[model samples]
Target: MDLRDERELEVTRRKLHVLEARYEASRREPDENAHVHELSLRSLKRMINQLKEEIARFELQTLRK
Candidate 1:
């Protein structure tokens, strides 16, 4: 991969890591507002899924190149 592609991959990975950490922490915490907490977790999960899909697409494109 070129420098730019490598940098983009690294940045995406870092974001994934941060989001995963946040998801785990949120899961472990006890929030008074259960509905809001559930919504927040769901949002984080959707973002994580999107990021994972982005990473997978990037890897597949790189492999095909």
Candidate 2:
């Protein structure tokens, strides 16, 4: 993978970490934490998208080199 692709992946990984922290912070035993959970879910989706884009870019880069 190219450097840019790896950088983007790293950013997404950091975001995932932040999301996980937020998710844990919002966790309340015997109570619903919809908002934080939702944020975490959305972050997961964003992470997935980032990963897909990185994969696509890596594939194209491979084709070039």
Candidate 3:
């Protein structure tokens, strides 16, 4: 991994944090559309997971260098 890859990983990590916060906020807020909230939370969780995977891959790639 080069400088560009490192920057990308940092961006992805930041995005994961933002999504996690949004997911928590959604859980705490009372909404009339509970189903929609659940769907949105699920989507956010999925994105967080993907970003985590990307970060891990980038780190491992860097380590191999």
Candidate 4:
């Protein structure tokens, strides 16, 4: 991978890590309101999925280069 691609991958990975940590923390916290907790978890999950897709796309692009 080129320097720019490597840097981007690193940043993406870090973001994924942070998101995962937040998701885990949210899961462990007591639910004050069922609806709000569910919404928060869903949002975090969606963001995590998007980041994962981005990382996969980046890797594939790098591989083809």
The candidate 4 region of ten consecutive residues with least summed lDDT is 1-10
Error of 3 at 61 (Å): 0.9
Mind giving the per-residue lDDT tens digits that candidate 3 earns over 1-65?
23347678777778889998998998899989999988888898888788788788878888999
Sorted by TM-score, highest first, which candidate order results? 1, 4, 3, 2
Best by TM-score, which number?
Answer: 1
lDDT of 4 by residue, 1-65 (tens): 22357778888889889999999999999997999999999999999998888888888888898
In model 1, which range of ten residues has the least summed lDDT? 1-10
In Å, residue 61's CA in model 4 sits off its true spot by 0.7
Per-residue accuracy of model 1 over 1-65 as CA lDDT, tens digit each: 22238678889889989999999999999999999999999999999988888888888888989
Better lDDT candidate (2, 3): 3
Clashing pairs in 4: none
TM-score of each: 0.91, 0.50, 0.86, 0.87
- Predicted structure 1: lDDT: 0.88
Q: How far out, in Å, is residue 50 in model 3?
A: 0.5
The CA lDDT of each predicted structure is 0.88, 0.62, 0.81, 0.87
Which 10-residue span in candidate 2 carries the lowest summed lDDT? 22-31
Better of 1 and 2 by TM-score: 1
